[model samples]
Target: MRRTARRAGKALGAGAAAALLALATPAGTAQAADGVLSIDGTEHEDPSGCFPLGDFAPPKIANLTDGTAWIWSGPSCDGQVTQQIDPGTSAIGRGRSLYIE
Candidate 1:
């Protein structure tokens, strides 16, 4: 009985650690082909074309597509284009425009 109780306690501890890790990890918008675009903190998932981002540039963004994505500094797929971001990668200074092709 005592050994059983100890094993249960260890299992609980492991479960708690896994939960903590999941919470600490940044979550991506799963399986989005076009990825999720954040313009001035607003998230846009999937589809294409200019969506009128106004003047607010995105300070950070994430690539939630199945493949890789490119983030640009300016609108209309122009300006400082970032390197290919794999799925689920996120960071700051990703600029305003995002295109996944």
Candidate 2:
């Protein structure tokens, strides 16, 4: 019984660590800023042209099975931006404009 309890505790700890890592890691759609734009004191790269006022960082991006990804700005923010990129594309270069709506 003691061994079983230990195993369960270890499993729970592992699961929590995995969840924390997932939250800390940025998604594929999140492009790291190249010190170009600054918004709300956070350096962000806005690929979508919608939020032109300043730089904005998306909380997370959802990967769809149809080769498209959905970028979520925030938990309460209703607006979402979708980006279409080539399958081989990985990173966005500096001075490049991302589509925003």
- Top candidate by TM-score: 1
What does candidate 2's lDDT look like per residue over 1-101, in tens digits? 99999999999999999999999987766443222232233343423332332234432222112232223333322245333433223332121123322
TM-score of each: 0.43, 0.29
lDDT of 1 by residue, 29-82 (tens): 544466676544677777454433335544565656565667666777678775
Residue 32 in candidate 2, Cα distance off native in Å: 9.9
TM-score of model 2 (CA atoms): 0.29
Candidate 1 stretches greater than 4 Å from native: 1-41, 49-58
Indicate which candidate wins on lDDT.
Answer: 1
Pairs in clash, predicted candidate 1: none
Please give the CA lDDT of all the candidate structures.
Answer: 0.64, 0.38
